[model samples]
Target: MGEDDDGGREVYGKMRAAAALRQIPRPPPTTFQEDLMEHLPAAIYTLLSCWTRFYQIGKNNHVVWDEAHFGKFGSYYLRREFYFDVHPPLGKMLVGLVGLLSGYNGHFEFKSGDEYKEDVPYVAMRVMLATFGVLMVPLAWYTAKELGFSNRAAHLTTIMVLCDVAWLCISRFILLDSMLLFFTVLTVFCLTRFHTERHDPFSPDWWVWLTFTGISIGCVASVKWVGLFVTALVGVYTLEDLWEKFGDLRMRKRDYINHWLARGLMLIGMPLFIYMMSFKLHFIILNHSGPGDAQMSSLFQANLEGNDFSKNPLEVAYGSKITLKNMGFGGGLLHSHVQTYPVGSQQQQVTCYHYKDDNNNWRVEKPWTLPKVDDAGEIEFLKHGDIVRLQHTPTNRNLHSHNVVAPVSKLNNEVSCYGNATAGDAGDHWQVEIVDDLVFGKREKVPRVRSLTTKLRFRHVLSSCYLVAPNSVLPPWGFKQIEVSCDKQNNPSDPHSHWNVESHWNGRLPVGETKFYKSPFLRDFWHLNVAMMTSNNALVPDADKEDILASSPTDWPWMHLGLRMCGWGDNQTKYYLIGNPAVWWSSTLSLGICVIVIAVYLARMQRGYRDWGVGEWDHFLYVCKIAGLGWFFQYVPFLIMGRVTYIHHYLPTLYFAVLMVGHLFDHFVFKSRRLKDTTKWVIFGIATGIVIGVFWWFRGVAFGIDGPIKEHWGLLWRKSWNIYESH
Candidate 1:
């Protein structure tokens, strides 16, 4: 009986213990709390770093560098200016939207270095850009953490970015670089997150990360085409990830196809949709005409409201007042002004002007006789191969070309408006051969303005040369417009010699059907893309005269130069865009160290020293390789680019390079088994402290503090910094 009672007590005691355990609250796992704690320092540092000098962004009430370009574009959007840029429209659209919301009138000219008057509301734009700039630090910090850097290393990486003077200067201005960098870094961070969670494949959380990464990629590319580099990086990583999955023995073929389909929909389809939507929004918002109309086609211009091209397309006839447009790409309207090429033929200069003006108008006439009007108001229609004379309206001179050489094209015959006499000489006579096409087994002469395919060649009767608008700019004497000359080769197929009547007026004929109705979006999209590409390709800065602020990719990695954003009165109110020297140099050195460490690791592995634990080291090495590849793709491509690049172009590369530095320091220095924790902390502390100190010292340049030149010079350690002083 005693034994049984003891057994019952034991069982009851065990039950009571179990109930007590269940009653006690099981607090949420510390893993999430641990993660928050781990990232706490970096989060705090990023916030303080971004917010510290944020308000000071608007101190300088003036336009700087490309601020003039982008600011004007923003205003143009609000006023519905049909402008063109080499980049995609999302960044400028955002600026425009912000300006509109803030009650900005969009009236400021935003000329280079122009001071904003008291009433001009420029603060909102600057603050908005600065806000994006400040966010870069946190984005970069998150990226580093996701890439497997330790907490201290992640915090230090944020510090390096926050302390960059170039980053600060660019952020504080109304520029696209900040927005571009923000989206680009966000893309990389999201991609890292996606990669980390990719083991789950088609899980809901995994899909969300993948989708976010795709959207971020679209946003980055929408800012600048340079975002393609990030796109390539993500693309390669994804392909490699999928390839590894396919090779996995346990993975079924069906799962592989599903993975591929999922990635295709998210990465390819989603990004394309978002990118097209950006352009759609751009086309919708900018409904009115602006300065950029001249760069587009007649059909495109006809679509804009309040544009001269939007007028009725008139019929062609003798004595018609018309504007002759070049049919070639980037061709302009035939124009003549009172000014002549000072050195060339001393007659009135005949050139091609991209915009419409009184000088562009000309009266069509027979070779020597005036067209007779019938009693019923009927007039002679200008036919193919008809010899005619073009009389300049403003100058009352005939379109003439002789053996004289052109100012720009020395080999070509000079074209000018000549002859004070109404009955001009043979030099004024030209055969107008209309471009023809076979229609229903018969060659039909194409009419002017009615058919865009119509091409005309003005063959000089005496000189035996064809009127040609070369893709070259004339001298200042010719108003710096496109050069129009007479080429000896009168190839009817040459587009440069092809002419079409763009603006026509004939009293005898009624106005034709209007071609300005809304067309299909795809057709407009195709045409606009072609026009934008043509315009962008034409924007080649002269290589012989390099701008003082221009930089090359080779110069970027060495921190060899700085750009002058703006200045007033010999360095007064100067804004110099230079990276923080300590940060740049340290990051640059870290890259070299990373290379050496990687080599040594490879050597050790080749010699069969594999005891370092394969899984952890392999993961670390893989992340480093990816970060290195990102840096390479961003920086190396600029080496071959022919465009005029600036120091700000290096900002994207700097983001990845700084991440590599953080990764290197975390793995090799901070986590080194040979080094004591105290020593590691000391090293990191000194490095970060120096970077912060330098950033604070040069904070004047970033914030546009105006004072004595010597005061600013005292803070610079590199002699290249003197470039700003001389400027």
Candidate 2:
């Protein structure tokens, strides 16, 4: 009886093992037709993408919205003229390359709403940038597949990306948005591919994908600062992966360390190297001095071709005409304009300007001297602790500060060009206190002031305050320049209070040699990055000013606003930047649905209910985490940012939400065992049909609306949209 029972139990165990093996999924036998069918979806998406992106891309022959700014930057690149902007150089460099390839001469000034000249290759440039937008569709399809979605879900992802009117419209212009979106999608694609190769760690394919992911990250970040949001997503995924590897008991300690090292090298080190390389190329190409020369260091500007700083005298003497540059990062030249502050002091505005002009030049004179007085006395070289009056060369007004509060920095005294050179009082007298030089340390005795080398501070004689120029910007009354104030706190370490003679002119002193003004690459790199960040931060929306094109972050997911890309004249071609309603609304709805489903699954698991097998559960969690977390990481930062945002800013974030829609549909409808295959195909057909229909209806907004926008009714799905002239 015992032997018979054992035989039965053994047979039952064998039956259970066979059932488990059957549960594991397997791919069908491959054939030429099957292989072709597998790639046909992405290929079809790519062809469709080309038509949509390139169709009528050149229909508008005028500069549209931001095309004015970005296209001008491209011209600056082609002319090899140095210019400064809030973004990194990679995207603009590509723009210049496209212009070069199109035989553009970089001669046309891309002013806003200006018509393109016959010789200008604006069409070719637009088509080249639109290529980035076109590639996004196929990349999305493959990204969905790498994330372990079904073919139906991959098709859905491609359709949503391809049909988005906002992405299509922005790509049709010569702007950085297309490049930013392309690299953003490419980063995610490479990340998913790397995640799939995790089962075989340290394999060639794994390293290749990881390297590509890092390269993509660098490219994305080099396009815009917002790319850091996607990079943060990669960081979170890596941390989770490393933590899982650490928990594996079967893994050797050496192997785990190797994993960390590989990730560190590929993700951190490689991206940094690539980012720095872009800046290096930027510096190499933009070697000539241009409008932005004053934004850089005195030593840096001396190297530029058009700048005459190298011809300036090395030493500063009494009556020397000089431009005082604030030594702080992102600081500007000491400038005084004809306009006066409305509230504070009501004197001529003493501010910091980023452009070189005669207004920025000041003459260093003895406090006791009268205006235009030729002193027959000995030529004395200016030294530390010299009491001098900085007379504005153009206006002849002395640099003056008083007890009145500054307009911007209330705690500091207001600085202004108060009285004429001969009529200034004790307030105009500033004690020249020498700070340590960049090349030379503090001397034991009084050190003679040297151009582009000595750092000095101008202390108010009456108020005992230090002259300062922080990153604070003045209002329009001050010509939107940086605010200059007198700080009450005499902090010696404060860089804002440090100033150096940028351009010195004295007949007595010798010219500065080129070697004396050489600056290091790393220093210049750090300086430019800080400057970019400073200018970008200053772009906060003003309460007193109304920007019609700006939109709140809350308006993004729902498509509550649409931007007019050009004038609404009946004869002019108009483009409205808005997303496809069907795609946007459905994708946004999926984001909320995803959170609820994940919460329910977690609660069920806590109660010991099994809705999915172990393998199936892992796959579900992986897909959801990628889609859900990617959307969260990209979207949340915009909510807290104070900078002015637009509808186009959300394009990168939209890609992830679209992925969530695809994944949720695949999980519940397309790949569900409870649903018949026919039902899944029908659902897919409805979804595809709705997206296409909506895209077709709104296609005029992207392809360029010809007639009066008021005639194009029903396009304003959202009440807040300014697409129509009445609105």
Candidate 3:
């Protein structure tokens, strides 16, 4: 009786399984129409983006705003000449590549407001750069889809990106902003792709997306230092992800170790390799010496073609023609010009210049009143405590100082070139005080000054002042060079007071060995990166002078002001960089809405209200974290940055805010069960209409305005915008 009962139960279970299997329906085959419909939104956005970015791109043939700068950098690349700039090389390399493909020979100087010559190919280059902007709309749409947004939310994201006027204006010109924006969006997109493959970790697809994410990180950072903000976002996300895995009790020790190894190799190691490779390529391409040679170390400049540092004498001696260089970080060559100071002693101006020229050459000679050294006499090596006069080789003026105040540094005495070769006074004397020696060690009784190694200071014999070149820049009359003054107080620790013989020439001494001047690639790389950061940080606003175009970071999100991209002359074509009000205001509002919504949800959860399923709650938190944190990382740093910022600096941050808008719409209206599908579609339509209408209304500000500015009165939606010419 027991065997019969068991048989009956097994038969009943088999019958139930067969019935369930028969009830399951097969998926329908994908058709061409269905696939086209699926991709139609991105395709449409791409088309619109191309239209907005490329339409009348060449209407203004004159170099506009930063095009004067970035276009010249591209020319430098094509000419294979080294030039120094605060930005990294990848974006400029791309610009050069565009010029090469368009048949530009790097002949055009691209002076601001200068009309492009017939052979410059400015239009084609602009068109190529605008392609990056053209791809941005589709990238945003696809990124939204990867983040699990509904179709309605994805479409809204695409429209918002497409309709932003400032993004459009920046892309249509020759600048790095477009490339920076594209790479930033690409990084986020790749990150979302990597996240979706977490369930199948260590698989081929997972590794591919992860590697792509790393490459994108490298590419973005190589364009600008601002790219680090997005990199930081990626870093935070990775840390959170690894922390979650660490908390998983089911994970094996070997698997966890493997995860750490993989991330270290692919994320940190790969991006660093890519960044270093860009600098390596930059050094290779720019082998010729150009205007920026003085900005680099003497050793690094020695390796460049056309540089004469390799031919320099090994040691400094009396009667040697030399250029003195400040040993401070990012310092320049001690220079003097024929122009006299408008204020102070009214003598020939002494300054620090970052370019190699005849003005930088000075001859080390005995005090003007002393007997001239014989040519055939035994060489008198310049040593510690030597009294000498640095005669301006071009003008034959002795380096002199007086009690008159300096033009910039008022506390310091004025340093100028006074007496000529024949005329002389006691003020012409300078005592050479050796600080230390890099090669020969500390000061010796007969210590010879080694070129490029021995640090020295010139003290005014009569005034007891140390000649110094501080970081203070002179006024426009002095060509905006670093100010040179005579310090009344002695300070051995100040690098600004330190000087070294950078370039020496004497018939008596032999050329230095190449081994002595070899600068390692890693050291040069580190030095250049630090110098760039230092220079970038020095770009703060001046309280004494007003810059009409400058705006505070607080003024960005609210659209308080807009920038005039070029001249406002009635005869010239112009562009105004302002955002579409509907998009910027709504996106900013979404940030506040996000904070309130998260708080309310947490309160409800505390009260035991289950508003969402487990998977839904997790998804909501994930998307919100990426959007909020991405915005935070990109924007909050600007508040503390000492550098002067423009509205365009906020462009990358705006992308994250726009993402928040899409996520909120998906969670509250589109995908929510509380909202009907008809209501969701209606709301999406109204939002899209507002965005498109505002963009159309302000489209001329980007596409280019012809004729008089007074004709385009409605372009200034905000009262503070400088779009209109002053009456």
Candidate 4:
């Protein structure tokens, strides 16, 4: 009887195993055609079709010099811009696809020398952006489905996101903002699905959730480190998801906690890892260098290795080039060039480097600097005003009077220091040495730090020099900003250092609890720990320098209206500036409007949050805190920027303002607590009004102002593109 019973049980177990195996067999693979099943994909394709055509619009125009990304596509197969410029490559990748489909005629491959054709590239890019913009509708629909939202509401959210001008403008640009949005949306969708499937521990749902998270974050990080901000924002949502599961569930506390821990590991942690991994791999796939200086790669590697990088996270992980640890001593390579501007000088006198072999020994040769020697005739400590003359450079004698900022080399182009075999021009040769620079401090009782400048310059145009400061002031510099200038031309010895004719001016801007200085959301926000104002580093081209400088007074031609231009399409160069006044006004308005709207939202929610579950408090806190964080990361940066001259390295800060404002708009307009109709209209009016009003301020009103504005509206357009003179 026992043997018979054992046989029966074994047979039953086999039958169960077979049934489970049958149920979980591998599914069939999805075909490429399967992805384009219906109206949704078709709409996406149509939208994309327009931008692919428009991005290369100026291919045949021959009007402008064609400095855009699409115009340079044909220069290389992958068609990326210059090596060191930091721009996300996803948009360019799409442009490449368009170029391929268009028989190398779209934005990526369109261009004839320095000019472009008609509306082709622009139109193409716009359509592509529109498609991506519209596609958000369906993706949001999917998110709603996963989040248990009704089809109707999901569809509504899609429509709202699509119609937003913020979305529209971002999509239209050859930038990564839209792509970042796309990734963000994808992450939400995946996370929603994961939330629904958490109960099934042994199911394939976890893997599905993991894969989506990885893809979404990889795309997000590829576009910008700003994606990290999104990651942090979503963390609140994750905690909420975990908290909800922990309460009123069948599982014990430990089991529930484990579920959340697993989810965090799979979703957030894995996503971050995959996001960083793509930075290393994507460039190889696209055949382009990854985002500027292989930063994304090194940052992740350093974190994992935990090898000395964390000691100064500021240097290793700043968005721009900070000295990399792996880059090695004095940030590696060295003794490149020397460019110094005695406190009173903007244009510099350079002293370059050379190498000589005496008999069998080699020595690094500098310009034989004549520092202030002691009475014993030995070179000693520097003080007061002392000049070091150059041994090789001619005194820029033949420079034309009309040439306001001509290159010194142009005055002696006849000299063949370049392209000749004698000066090591045919190989990777460099001048090697180091120089120390002294800087003023701003922090209380903070002593000045030594700045070691060592680098390798192009074709061996190396130089060497030292600097001395009164050593007064505090927090001397960001250490990186220790150079003499932020402007490129003023940097006679090295191109990397920045210069600002005005940043070093004595005294600080007045600071207090003004609207601009106050934190929009949070109280007790950190004061400016350090500040470094910079000038645009873009060089004055040989052909345009004279024309640019001629627009303003000789004293500060850099402020000339003629050079203050940045526009595209219909606006062109009317009164252009890289920074649109309309945009700034809109951004500022967006902040004020956002606060007003969110405040009204929370006030209404407080009236009835008690009726809902604890989840309401979590959501409320997120909204409240982020509103403050938005100001910290965005509004505050801009307000601080306004206190000083605008600089180039601060360009990324504008993006922060734009994105935060967009989020603030999105939160109140689309996702605010289900509120009254009167509240919705009120919020909409304020936010929309502010944006429009600000836009108008930049476009129509800035040039009309008199006083300093009237004297040189032409010179200040780097702040806006279209000023009156070159006024």
RMSD of each: 10.7, 5.2, 7.8, 19.1
Off by over 4 Å in 3: 1-37, 327-329, 336-351, 357-359, 367-378, 383-499, 506-517
Ranking by lDDT: 2, 3, 1, 4
- Per-residue lDDT value at 370 in model 4: 24
Residues 1-727 of candidate 3 have per-residue lDDT tens digits of 7655775656766764553343313225569997788689888889989888989899998999999999999999999999999998899999999999999999899999999999999999999999999989999998998888989999999899999998999999999999999999999999998887887789998999999999999999999989989988899989888886776555698999989899888889888998899899998999898877788767678788887777788878888999998877677889999999999779899999878889999999998677886768888888888899889999999899988999989999999998898887888899999988766677773368878778888899999999898767776688767889999999988888999888899988898853355667887787678667756765777766788888888998899988888988889898888899988999999999999999999999999998975367778888998899999999999999977899999999999999999999998899888888899999999999999999999999899998999887777677787777562
Residue-pair clashes per candidate: 0, 0, 0, 61
Residue 368 in candidate 2, Cα distance off native in Å: 3.6
For residues 1-727, could you state the per-residue lDDT of candidate 1 as single tens digits?
7655775566756754553343313224469878788668657766775675474767777787898999898898888878877678899998898778767788889998888877667887777777788788778777877777776788788898888888888888788988998998899989988876755678887999999998998899888888879888888888987876655545689999998998899888888888788888887887787877655555556677776544444556777888887766667789999886787779898988877689999988677655432425657777777788899988889999889998888889999998853556778889887665222121263544242334567888888899998667764456557889999986877877988676777656676644533445665565456555544555545645667778777777778888777774644577778888887787778778888888898899899887464245656766776778888888888887756688888998888888888888888788688999899999899979998998888887787767666654565566665443655
* Model 2 lDDT per residue over 441-526, tens place: 77434369888888899999999999999978776667667899999998999989999999888776688775455878898888
Per TM-score, the best of the predicted structures is 2
Q: CA lDDT of each candidate?
A: 0.76, 0.88, 0.87, 0.35
Candidate 2 — worst ten consecutive residues by lDDT sum?
Answer: 19-28
Write the residue-wise lDDT of candidate 4 on 1-727 in tens digits: 7655775656766764553343322325557676445346336533543343233332223322223543343233344321222333444455555445444443334332333444345445434544554455456556544543333334333433433333434444333445566666666566556555554653787668756765676566555544545455456556765665554334478877776676667656776565444433333433343222222222222222212323321211001112211111111111112233232222332211111111111111122232221334422221112121111222211100111221332221111111111122211122222222212332222222111111212212222221111111111111111121112232334423211110010011121111111111111000000110111111212342244422222112122232232322332322223334433444446556656866776787778643334344343344334434523442233333322222222222333334334455444455556776577667666654554544444432212122334443333436533444333
Better of 1 and 2 by TM-score: 2
Best by lDDT: 2
Q: What is the full ranking by TM-score, best candidate first?
A: 2, 3, 1, 4
C-alpha displacement of 299 in model 3, angstroms?
Answer: 1.8
